[model samples]
Target chain A: MDLFINLAHGFSVALSPMNLLFCLIGALVGTLIGVLPGVGPVATIAMLLPITFGLPPVGALIMLAGIYYGAQYGGSTTSILVNIPGEASSVVTTLDGHQMARQGRAGPALAIAAIGSFIAGCVSTVLVAAVGAPLTKLALLFGPAEYFSLMVLGLVFAVVLAKGSVIKAVAMIMLGLLLSMVGSDIETGQSRMAFDVPELSDGIGFVVVAMGVFGFAEIIRNLENQSEETRSIVTSKVTGLMPTWPDLKASAGAITRGTIIGSILGILPGGGAVIAAFAAYTFEKKVSKDPSRFGRGAIEGVAAPESANNAAAQTSFIPLLTLGIPPNAVMALMVGAMTIHGIVPGPQVMTKQPDLFWGMIASMWLGNLMLVVINLPLVGVWVKLLQVPYRMMFPAILIFCNIGNYSINNAPFDVGMTAVFALVGYWLLKLDFEPAPMLLGFVLGPLMEENLRRAMLIARGDPMTFLYRPISATLLAIAVFLLVLAVLPMIRSKRDVVFVEGET
Target chain B: MSDGIQAPSGRSGGFRIRNQQDFYGGLVLVAVAAFALWASRDLPGMRGFAFGPGTAPRIFASILGALGLIVAVGGLVTDGPPVERVAVRGTALGAVLIAIFILVSNYATPITAGLGLRQYETVLAAIVVLLVTIAIARGADRGPLYVVAGTLVFAGTIRPLGLVLASFISIVVCAAATVEVRWRETILWAAGLTIFCALLFVYALNLPFNFWPRF
Candidate 1:
């Protein structure tokens, strides 16, 4: 009953003229950038952070959320049409989505993806609303020790779930923690690593690092394979705009199962959406009677992963909204946005600012609805936009990103800093180090340190407090278990098999 | 997996270093950790169980250093993929040259200031290095160099020259990053984008951006 009333209030807020407009704009711009290969949601959100500075907190958040869904939707479109997955989550989509396109069933593949995503979005939005309040309540049980332990678990989850060498991932996390310690200490106000630069006192801006690592580094990498300029775009006109009844019936079960998988995984602190899509597609294949049909124009392939990813994308917000912990880099950027708006994320947000909380939740549903309506009819437009060569597109992105960086603090030094990090990101790519874990570590570092210090002080310097507390101990135990599981050679091979997408 | 590591050190008559990526990557991490430790050396540490600013940093840095060492050792004992080759020679060289130039300029300030070129020294040095590096760099490798140069141009010019000129120059400069650039098309596109960005950011969004050069 309370959920109903709260949702009603949320609908009222989301339906407001200004909020709706922002949602629409966010969806459009998100799709626009997400359609472009090499730019992920992290960079998109970081680049657009400056634009949200002036917006009211609710509107700003709504817009950012809209951008996320739009970006994912656009990624599917790119996969189907160009066989180029816009980002990692969409990589599996290209397996069968593009196959469907090649077989001249591009329209049905796209329609099913959109429909599946919409259904998943609807289900997950409700799940988020339902789960958010209880999770916030659960958060009330957490002490400083518990919070610290939880963060440790979250980082471990990131490492275990991330596709890379476990040792390298752990190293990256440590490096991120080290980098996060650059600014002044919270308790003492004593600068740990300003290096005499005034700007360093604020610590490195998250936006600058994000734009540098994901944005500019991606450009550098994309430039590497420009010699293979052949992009096989499906020039055939997309005729059937809707999936047939049989296509719908075939994907119904897959969609439900995908939504379930995505919702569960999305709550975990890791690369939820990427793994969710992969897991969904793999599960679909495993359960199918004719598993061999998966990579060869199977509509279930397009439906399941798309649904899972969208569901995962939305439900990943659960951790961020409930516990004040961002599950991934994109959510970390959301934390930055919230901080900038003078709204601290956590359990308190629900009780203190119910309107903001519920309104953002409601806006997500509306945003999903908008994506379906805006994207389906606009598929041809997106396909046309895809024909724009990368050569011309990159410079525009570069200029805009530079301008965006400058706008953050009106500081040119930030621009220079971004260039440096871009170099670092490019170098990391060469070294086979995944930047995602490092980013998650950077986001959680200060919080973890603060909690650890508080817990220690409360326990009068006894390290045993973490072990003594049941919740904290459990979290730490799980983290260790996950770490061990990831390190085991047998599990590692299985993990690799799950991630292997058949590239034609 | 057993062939390389299980064999005696001199079995193949060589001390083979496997997994160069992890080896170098781990070494770099160790260096970074060391740098962090050095940077935080002055901050106070534990005072009777209470952390004094530096405790957390020193702790994490030490952990990172240990982890880095483990990775480096793993690289030695384990056989894995070799480091992927990337066209970073030009980019790396440019960075090295820039560092050298900055160090020399800082140390030899008296020499540079005597010529009344102190204010222009860094900027001039950067431009020259960028040009030389771009010229010498392979066609594919120039992307990052040109992109970096473009960003620096925007950073350097945005204040003095204002948004229009800064954005225009940066866009044009960045277009040269790829060999596929068509000059006329790029110039027109840059100009159009400059106008659009200036209007959107300055007028529509009303961010406090100057339209023309302050001077």
Candidate 2:
């Protein structure tokens, strides 16, 4: 009863004229960025974060949330039209969606993708509202030991889920943790890694690091890929905007199963839209009567992953909103944005700011609806946008990144730091080390440190208390199990095969 | 399974010997971890019932050092592709541009003070001319040159030229980075973006910034 009343209040807030307008704008911009290759949501959000500084917390959060899910919808457009996955999560869509486009079923593939995503979005928004409260309650029971163990588990999962060498991923996590210690220590206020620079006293800004690594490094990588000059985009004959009844019948089961899989996986630490999409496509192949139909215009291939990614995108917020733990880099950026808005995300957020919490949940549903309406009609516009040369697009992105970094503290030093990190990021990419794990570590490092110190203090430096507590012990055990699973030769081989297939 | 550690074909180039990207990456991480550990050694640790600030960092640093060592060892034993060559020209040009921006932004006042210049604007103008000439002489790509010019100009002139004109100049300069720049399109984009940013950032959001230069 209370949930319904709260949801009603949420609808009132989200439906208000001002909030609705922001939601529409966020969704629109999210779609635009999502359609543009190489400009992922992380860079777009970081670029636009400064604009939200003046918005009321509710309006600001609603807009950011809209952008996230909106990107999921927009990502499919490029995958189907140009055979290019605009976002990582949309990579699986290119396998079948593009094939469908070549076969003149582009309109049906896109329409099904949007519909599946909408269904998943609606379901996952309900899941967020339903599960958010219970999870917050569970989180309130966590002690310092439990929280520290949770972070350890989270870091371990980050390594397990990362692509490429496990050793490199672990090293990146450690490096990120080390980098996070550069500012004044939280406990003693002693400057640790400042090197006598006053700016270092407060630590490197999260926006600077994100923009440098994801935004600037990405630009450099795009430039390095000189072979991408001749792109073949399929914009002609985009007929059949709606799926046939037979297509709908075939995908209904896949969408339902995908929603379930994605909703569950998304709540787990280090499980996000990309993993969920990959997992769903693999699951669809396993369950299909003819698996070979998958990369060759299979509608189930398009529907299942699309639904899974959208559901996962929404459910991935559960950890951040309830536990204040960011499961991925995108969520980590959300944490940064929330902190800037003076709202520390944790269990307390729901209890203290019920309107903000519920309004965001309700707005997710509204945003999904807006995306369906906005995307179907604006497909032509997005296709035209895809025609813009990367050369022209990159400069605008660079300018926004520069202005965005400068706006953070009205300081030139941050821009300098961004340039430095961009170089580091490009180097890391050259070495085949994924920067995503490092980002997760950077975001979680301070919280993990604070909890570790508190836990150690409470246990009188025993360290065994983590093992003694049931929840912490269980979490630690899971981390160990994941590590062991990752190392086993058989499982490692199998996982690599799966990842390689997905990559292709 | 035995060949799992090998670099996937086609990714390696001349820089790496024996496809040792992991080896080099591991070496860098180890160096960083060793430095962090050494630097934090002097900080206070455990005191009475509470853990000191250094305790957490030391713990993390030690773990990181151990991980780095393991990765380095793994990298050495694994058979993989040769390391790829770094984009030296692009990287160097980027570094130089950033260096100039930082140097000018941080030292413009001191440089002007030493030169006994009357106004900061005059010093800024002189620095811009010198940097732009150097950038062009070095055969820097239009992208980096434009970025350097835009950022430095925005930083130096934000206070004097105000938000609108400074941002306009920055955006236009940045738009000119591309090879296929059309003057009409660039100017229109510059004007539109300038007005949109001003309206959104300054007018609607009411950020604490000047609309026009005070001087």
Candidate 3:
């Protein structure tokens, strides 16, 4: 079979001793950083960008890819144990995972997280093998307008799904768009907010803002709370290496459905892992025999989101590999890294580097296996990390904070900006202004501004063209429809929750 | 959205400078916008460079200032939820620690001179900051102040220390400063982590520069 032959070629490229070793190491670091509160995989991979400067591009990409997904697995660990979701995708996990922990069922919670992730990883890998080429072809239809519209839709969906006021969520998304535009104008090469600082010529780095806001701010907030009643969870003994037969059966079908659903969703521009996680949860809730079980500590709640997030993490690679468009921050950073290596991502990438493409894909399976093995044995270690007092652990996190901020360029100016932003982030956190949407604004703001300006210039400042251009107009139309409808879904959800609570 | 991070900003004074969150957010935005508007005098419209570099940032940052004002106004209009304020003691200590950060950050920039010496300056400053920070943390009634200050200072200095030294020291000192371990316990934890990172980053990973002396 062509699949077998191609996979064989892939394995040949992937199975080298050095490659295997790097895969394991990447998995280890990914998991470690995932356990650590502040730094996630995207920034870690970005921090290591310079290290890969001289290495072969294939090896570099393979390792970076490993770190990305491996962190996805590791992220769930903290969420399950400590109620701190290390990455955005894992936020849904905290709903039930932390609930299970408070009930002293932490062992089972962590086990399901690892097992669900592994199953989804395998299922997604198979999907990637079966449909990567075709999906890559499908992705060719998207242009800048499509990408922008898709982002708008995704943000609206996120706001729709977010557990907060709809007005605030919309405000957050708009805020995120605005914040993202704060740097230099990409098209016109105009400095948007650099203020003549050499370091800011590139704009505010997300890593600094994310770490400062989510990571540091979280710690500060936690410190202020007088609830000293953190109980130590004992999972030193794997009370259940295997999920009870009922547990396995309940999640098995959900995992399969989530993988399938996530695979298709991921191929769409802007539908990355976090979106996949939320979408899968929504799907599971809709199809559940008893929808009331969700949000109140349903095992399926954990299983579906975990599966979808990982599957989406893999499949989102379609656009990046095929058309060279990066739909998210991590992928954007990957684009920057690849551009540095002079290997343009597009159709020719697969052809010119069969070994690279196939090998990276093959390596993911092996990497997943390594993650399960390495992460499972280390679950007890991570659970114990929860026992480490905040007073003691806070300093070490700061050190990582410094290192991560510094590694962005080893420039003091970046460090200063991070502090400035951290203070700003802390203030926003206090004011009920969501920082995540601000980040979204920060990420997409510049792009949107650039594209808007370009369209204007092309039309000689004829603003009407934005509404008249077929592709752009359609996207804008869809964005408007979704934006307006975002709150409707929430009212439905609230009514459903109230009804469920009354019945229960 | 408050998620109980702050005891909802108290309704007292209706918008005191004491609310550090909106203060810095507003102050920074207003200051930066003022600077941008001042600097824009140098740029021409539709110059050879498709659009001059300052054109977009000035406009964007100005909007940021306006947004900040809106956010601040919102804060001023609302009463924070009822909860015990984070001990003013903790907030005051935080301010003191931040003052230390500003001193080091504003001064350390010129001191580094952008030479290779920047690494040493960053590391040494981080060390001194870490020690003083930890001492303050342990000695003061305030909690986690040292860790926050140390982190802020290190984040402030990291760019000067190349990735290797900065990351290594930042992790080492911050971990040392924050973790609630016995001195003997911390020394081992700190030394072991430092050595392990040194080997992994320097020897095995082969990143340039040997930060700690190898005897």
Candidate 4:
């Protein structure tokens, strides 16, 4: 009954004319940027952060949620139409989505993807509402030791699930921690490693690092592969906008299973939409009677992953809202946004700011609905946008990023730092190091340090307090077990197979 | 440890690097760790139970150093793909062009005055601009050098030159990054983009931005 009342209040806030307008604007801009060749959601959201600066906290957060869904839908569109996944979550979609395009069933494939994503969104939004309260209750049980241990588990999950060498990933995490240690200390107010730069005293802006690493680096990389083959688009006409009954029937079970898998994985500390999509597609293949049909225009292939990714994207918010821990890089960006608005995310968010909390959850449903409604008829428009040459597009992106970074705090130094990080990003790419884990580590660094310090103080400097606490001990044990599982030769080989199969 | 011992006896001679990517990547990490250590050396460390600012950094840096060593050693023992080749000519050209732009923008006015050639300042600037464009047009496969140069220009000029000129210059420069650029088309596009951004940011969004140069 209380949930109903709260949800009703949430609807009232979300349905306000101004908030609705913001939501629409965010979705439109997010899709516009997301459909471009090389700009992923991380870069897209980072580039668009300035637009939300003046809005009320509720509207700002609601619009950000809208942008997230829109960017995801845009990524799926690119995957189906261009054989180029806009981001990693959509990579699996390219296999069957692009194949379906070649077979001239692009309309049905797209319609089914939207349908599956909507259903999954509907299911997971309810799941988020239902599970949110209990999780907040659980979060209340956590002490400083548990918080530290949980973050450690989250980092381990990121390293384990992330592709590439584990040791290198761990090293990247340490580097990120060191980088985060720059600027003024919280307790002592003593500056650490700033070298007396005024900008460094505030520490590095999240937007600066994200725009530099993801946005600029991606443009540089796309330029490197500027050969004709990379940007080829399927120019076939998309005729039938509706999926047939048979197509719908084939995908129903896959959508359900995907939603279930996605919702569960999304709640995990480090598991996010990318892994959810991969797991769903893999699981669907294992369960299908005709697994051979997967890569060859199967409707279920488009349905399962799309549904799972959307579901996972929404559900990943659970950890962020309840535990004050961002599950992935995208969530890390949200934390940055939240901090900007003077709103701290955690259990207190639910109790102290019920309107903002519930409003964001309700707005997500509205955002997903808006994507389905606005995007279907606008498919032709998006296809036309994608037709714009990459040469033209990259410049506009570069300018937009420059304006966006500059607009944040109206600081030119941040813009210069973005250029520097772009070089760093390019270097990281050359070395084959993953930047995602490093981002996760950077976001968590200060929080983890604070918790560890508090925990130690409470235990009078005894490091064994982490082991003495049941919850903290359990979390650390899971992290260790995951590390061991990742390092085991048998499991490592299988993990490689999963990734390799997706590419082939 | 066993792999490290066996690496010397394997097909290649002693101490031959097997995976150059991790080897070099790990070495860089170690260097970064060392730098962090040096930077935080002044901050106080642990005082009894509580951390004193520098403890966490030092701890993380040490761990990074150790992890980097392990990775470097692993690269020595493990067989992995060699590092991919980086395109040198294009990137070098881009870096040089950016350096020239920075030098010209920062020092051109002062140097011309110092040489008592202040009357020829515009000529000098125009010549440098022509040289940059010609070099851009003539260079084979320039890649994305102009893109970086344009961003830095916007950062340096946005405040003093304001949004209009900054946007115009940035778009024009960025458009030249690609080899397929048609100059006339790019200029028209830049004009249009500048107007759109100016109106959207300044009027519609009500952001505080100067449309023209402050001077």
Give one clash count per candidate, in the order shown: 0, 2, 26, 0
* Ranking according to lDDT, highest score first: 1, 4, 2, 3
Q: lDDT per residue, candidate 4, B1-215, as tens digits?
A: 24324664645455588888788788889899899999999999989988899999999999999888887777787767776554334445555655565466556788767877543343344346436755664443444456666776777668767899888887888787667889998998899888888888888878887777653
Q: TM-score (0 to 1) for chain A, all models?
A: 0.97, 0.96, 0.78, 0.96
Q: Candidate 2, residues A63-85: lDDT per residue as tens digits?
A: 99888876767778888898877
Sorted into a CAPRI-style docking class, model 3 comes out as: incorrect
lDDT of each: 0.84, 0.78, 0.60, 0.81
> Using DockQ as the measure, which candidate wins?
1
Clashing pairs in 2: B16-B83, B19-B81
Better of 3 and 4 by DockQ: 4
Could you give the candidate ranking by TM-score, starting with the highest?
1, 4, 2, 3
Candidates' TM-scores? 0.95, 0.90, 0.75, 0.93
Q: What TM-score is obtained for chain B in each of the predicted models?
A: 0.80, 0.66, 0.54, 0.72
Model 1 lDDT tens row, B50-163: 988999999999999988987787677766677644534645854654464445434655754777654444444445545665666566667777777777767666776789
Which candidate would rank higher by lDDT, 1 or 2? 1
Q: Clashing pairs in model 1?
A: none
Q: Which segments of candidate 1 are over 4 A away from where they belong?
A: A490-497, A500-504, B1-4, B7-13, B85-91, B97-126
* Complex DockQ per candidate: 0.58, 0.37, 0.22, 0.53
lDDT by residue (A65-105, candidate 1, tens digit) is 98888888888899999998887888989999999999999
> What are the per-residue Cα lDDT tens digits for candidate 3 across B11-94?
865535434444444454556556656655454445432344454545555665665665444344334342224433444455
Give the local distance difference test score of model 2.
0.78
Candidate 4: pairs in clash:
none
